[model samples]
Structure formats: C-alpha cells, structure tokens
Target: NEVFDNLAMFAGYGFNKSHSAAYGMVTYQTAYLKAHHPVHMMAALMTNDADRTERVVRLINETKGMGIEVRPPDVNASSLDFTVAEGAIRFGLGAVKGVGHSAIEGILQARKDGPFLNLYDFCERVDLQKVNKRVVETLVKCGAFDSLADGPLPAGDLEALGHWRGRVDAAVATAFSLGQKKQADRDAGQGSLFDVADGLEAGPVSYPEASPWSDQVLLDAEKQCLGFYVSGHPLDRYEEELGVYATHTTETLERAAEREAVKIGGVVAELKERRSKRNDSRNAFLTFEDRAGQCEVLVFGARYAEFEDLLKKGEPLLVQGSVRIEGDEEPRERKIICDKVQLLLDAREELVNKVTVQLEADSLDEATVCELRDIFKKHQGDCATYLRLRVTLAGQAHFKLPVEYSVRPTDDLLQAVERLFGRGSVSLG
Candidate 1:
C-alpha cells in the first residue's frame, strides 16, 4: 500500500526534466552503441526479448539491412543466446520458443569439444534426460541439424526430426519400464513379465526426405526462436515486381516531402470512408505499411471512386501524389493527398489500364497481321483500346506504325499467347 501510494504520487507529479535527462542519456548510449557496434547490440537485444514477437522482428530487420547476416539456429553451431561472430549475428537456440534454456545449454556444452556429425552420434553422446525430444524437435524445425543428416528433401529434415522425436519419446518410456523390470528381475532371480520396447536404435533410424517449406512456414519457424523472422522479409517476394511501379522506397519518400509528384509504395493496412461536413462529397482515408514504416494517405472526390476496390486491406499499392504538409491548409492535418492509388507493378508500365500484345515482327506472317486487324474491325470492343506493334529488327530500320486498331487484349489472351507462342514471340506490351 505504501509503495502504491508513492508510485501514484510520482505518476501524478512526475519531474519531466529529470526523467528526460535520464532518458536522454540512455538514448544517447543506445544510439552511440548502435552506430558503432550493431551485431552485439542485436544479439543482446535478442537475448533480452527472446519471447517477444514484433520487437525481435524489427531488430532482425534493422540488423540484416546493416549487412549483418543472421544465420538460423543450429544444433551444432549455436550458443544458448544470440552470438556476434565476424560481424554476423548467429541465431540463439535457447531463444526459440518451447525449447528450454537448460536443455539447450546441455546440448551446446555436450558438443563444445566438437559438433555432433549425425543423428546416431547426437543420441550416443547427449544426455537423453536433459536434452530430450522436445529440444531436438525445436532444433530440427529451425534447421539446426542441416549439417548432420541428409533428409529426403530439404524439408524432409523436419519430418525426419519429428519422427525421430516420437521415437525418442517411445524409447525413453520403454527404457524406464525395462529398467524397473530389470531391478525386480535381479532381486527375484528371474525375468520380469514386461517386454520393454526400446524403440528403433538411433543408428538405424532413417531420415525422411525433407522438401523446403514455403515462405510462410520458414517465417513461422523464425518467429519461434528469435521472436521474429531473421532469414527473409515477408515483402521480399513481391518487391521486384512492385519496384517497377514504385518510384520511391519508404526512406526516399520520407525525404521527398518537399518534392513534387512523389511516388510511394506499400501494402494497404486500412481504409476509411468519410463524407465532408461542408458538402455532400466522398473521400477515403488510408493507412499503408511498407518495409520501413506506416503512412496515412487521403484520396478526395473522384479519385476515391476510381480506386475504391483497390483500397482493401493487404492489397499492395503504389501511390502517386503530393505530400500534404501540416499547416499547409487552415487548421492543417498531415497526410499524403493521393492523385492515384494502384498496383505498383501494374501502374508503372509505359501505358496503364490497357493491355498490349506484341508479335514477333520478323516471324509474323503478313497475312496473319492483316487477319488480326480484320477480326478486330468486325468486333468493336471499345473497353480495351491500347495496342502496339514493333516490326524493325535491322539496325536503324525504324518502326512502321500499323493502321489505327482497337483490340481487347484480355488477360486470358495474353496468357494464352505467352504459353503457346513462347517467351520472345509474345509480350503484354
């Protein structure tokens, strides 16, 4: 009660100056350390928050971007906590969720003189009671035993590890039962009734074929140990395609506040609809997250309707617009005022909202090209209007624009041509 009373009083009338001073010193220390030595900082950070999910993830992201490689937790190589070696951050086995630190330490210390080369070697040397099946399973899931066994596929290691853990469990149970029977049999001078199952001997146990898991599976495993993904970013898969339309990364956009006609990319996290208090009009408020951080954007009037369906959550987008600085308007609010919201990959092509099909200029039969034109003339599909033809292959031989044609280059048609005609023969121009 006394402690609570003191805390309440301090909370109500805290000394901001003194607190700020203390906080400033700590902040400076952190900044200085981070700028000078990042790997040690990351390893220590991982140790402190070995159970947290997001913090560790953020740290991992920050660390990797600094060129420090975070190797996955391994049975033979890893220490109990994260370690900094040669400017790289090694994943801590003990940091993995569900695996006990004591068990991890036991395994590490057992292999201190050397690494366990195979499954049988691991079982033979390791203390089964301390570093049991559960610990081994965590290692396997995190690709800890990649150095030892050759599983069927890259992913077969996990399956093999799971199977082996089950066997280890069964083996322990049988061994306990057998030991009890042996004691009784020795006293009675006869065999006991129990026939204990020792399960499969470690040497004969075959490793399952392990195929590599999809991106999501690998991420989940990373999440288990270091509190976040240490191997790859979730956005890495779409980054290349997304880059085509996105003119600026998060960092560049933040610095682009004063520039005109900025382009930014992100995954849409939220969207809100609103009506103006002054008049009957529609607008959208958007929140998006890129690799760096979150930004809020606003789309006013007709543009909102143009991009309504695209504002859905988890939809990745590239937005081209002006940065709305705070106080730029009366009683101003800070935001990005969007001129356009679109798929970065889809929007940045030379032409947009239109599909173009290009035929091999040299290979195309002149009759076929004319036939394509005649067919389009018969069916007037005004909805899809963009078309292009490239014909000059010889040096300085200029392109000859064909007759004005309107053709609906649907996705199906593009895919069909790409599949049938092969790579160079067709392109979504």
Candidate 2:
C-alpha cells in the first residue's frame, strides 16, 4: 500500500510538469506569432471566430489596438475568409449577416471575369435567384458596395440624391428590373441590345432625388446587418464631450475598485426590462457601449422608475453608478448599479458653464472677428464666452465677452468655433 501511494504521488507530479511544459511552449509560440506576424495572426483569429459576433468584435478591437486596420466587407475585394490586404485585414463576406455560403459562391463566381462595375452591373451579372434583394440590401447597408461609388456616372446625369449609398438604394428597383429582363432574355435564348453587332446599349442608370440618412441611421443599419459598426460609431461625433464628462470607460471599468462611484457615457446598445416576482417591482438591464467596448448597467426598483423614460436603446446617455463586483475568479463578474441616468446632451448643457476660445494675435483680423460674432449670434444662450489671445511668444491676454456675446455650448456651436479657429481652440468649463 505504501509503495502504491508513493507511485501515485510521483505520477501526479510528472503529469503536472509535462502539462506545464506544453502550455509554456504554446504560450511562447503564440507570443512570437503576435509580435512577428500580427496582421496575419489576427486575421486568422477573427476568421476562426467569425460566427461568434461578440468574439469577433473583441478581436477586431484588439486588431485595431495593434495598429492594424480592419476594412469593412467589400464585394470587390473580400473573399469567403478574412484576407490580408495591403498590410490590413479585409473583412470576410461569409461572416456578413444575411449572406449565405451559396450567396458568396455566386458573387465570387460572377466576379471572376472582372470586378463589378457598378450596382446595376452587379445585379445583372450575379444570379439574382441565389443572391436575392435582401442579401444585396444587407451588403449595401454594411458598406460592401462602397467601392463601386467611385465609378463615373454618365454625362448629364445629375440629380440631388444624397450620398452614393442613397443613390444606390434609390436605384435598386430599377437595377433589379433591368437585371430580371436580362436574365429572362438569356433563359429564353433571345439576344438583347448588347448582343447586337451595332454599338447599341441600354440607357444610363438613373437615381431619384432623396434625402440622405443621418449618421446614426447609417450606423444602426451597419449594426443590424454586421452585428457591429464598420464605418464609424454613432457616438463618434460626441468624442470630445465624452472625454470631458465621462470618468470611466468600458476598458477602465475592468480595473475599477469594487463599489467605486463612477460616471460613464455611452450609447445604449440594448435594454431588457424585468419585474421582480416578490414585489413586482420593475428593473432593467442595459448593454452600454462606448468607444472602447460594452458593459452592463443595472437599474433596479426606484432607479428604474426614476429614469425609465431615458433608458432608450440607441440613445446616448450619461450614467452615474457604483461598480459592483462579485466572485474571486480570475475574471470577476462586474456590473454597474445605476444611481442616476440622463441624456448626454442634456448633461453637457447643464454641466458646461463657460466656453473659451484661444487665438493667435495675427489671426484675429476684422474678418475673423466678424465670423466669430456671427457664430456666437447663431447659437445664443447663457454659457459665458471668453477669448484668450497670444499677443507674443511669452505674452497672452484674456478677455471676457459681454453677456450679449455669450453662446450655448452645443455641438454645432463648438464645431463652428473649431472650424473657424482650429481644433483644440475651444475648451468648455
């Protein structure tokens, strides 16, 4: 019995040592690949986890952090798997929502002759039966057809249709009509105008006038179709404001102290309302996303009732809460227990009391002064304005504008000021 026990102990130690050695070798290999071939390694990782949206989002962010760009899916460039293109990663079509393997195969086969010329050409060439209108719409929304926008339009074909995406969307029906006719003609073994010996061809594709979608609308469409933002985030325009007001971001929250009071700003990515069985009190869980990533914010009982109206999805919000940490595991579960919530725009207006613009002495000419006055007049409000002039290399002067020159510190007003003077010229207090 003693000998058997001794043998068992030795066997356990030997197994543990061998396991550690194997794990250490794998770690070394992974680190070497990450350092030497970051782009390829990241592309492989993203492609491996393409079906998992959350994992893909995290990996894409990490890829960006490594100074590698991950371009959106392009019908002209992307393949079934993520590929390295010009030292960057091109998103895969297979990962795109609403696009099946068959659709990808059809697109790949159709584009084998050459690149797709335009939306009309793409619709006419591909098998519309397999790559249906919904798939095309999803691709358009996710920016796969953005490259085709650079193609030249026919002469004298001018319209007020907003952006290239807007024009393409408006012309989808007409393009589909033409594509269907061509397909029917081919199936019937009938020659179309293009097949004629003469240089006869179809008329130019025309797009109707339509207003462009807002940035938020475009971003929402991307999120709906690709499960993440490709071109830009909805909160991108509010970056400066968030930097000034937010005390904690999703990335920073990982290291935050338990029960630490914190203020965070983000767009509400998702929301779920629930009722307690014991008292039937209402509560809610919100998936809040900032520039870095996403986190959960919990609003319970009284807090939920106090801010129920403001807890809307896709709206930017400023949340004040305490970090609640549970478990002593390697990755502890963390969530924010909401104490207060308000619209980010409203918070900016209420918190900022002063706006200061810095200018060089030489640039503050009569015309510049007039433009500044016009900007102030356009956004009249209660926030006080001050001008700081750099008179010389080591000398400066500060002047407080009269109450009449004061203006609201809204985004438009700030943007106008920055545009006139330059970025980093306007600071809000």
**Highest TM-score: which candidate?**
2
- Which stretch of 10 consecutive residues in model 2 shows the poorest summed lDDT? 153-162
Which pairs of residues collide in model 2?
A: none
- Tell me the tens digit of each residue's lDDT in model 1 across 212-255: 35444554554454455444444554454455556666556655
TM-score of 1: 0.48
Model 2 residue runs over 4 Å out of place are 1-28, 151-162, 193-206, 355-378, 385-402, 412-427
Cα lDDT, all candidates: 0.61, 0.83
Reference-based TM-score of each model: 0.48, 0.82
RMSD of each: 11.8, 5.3
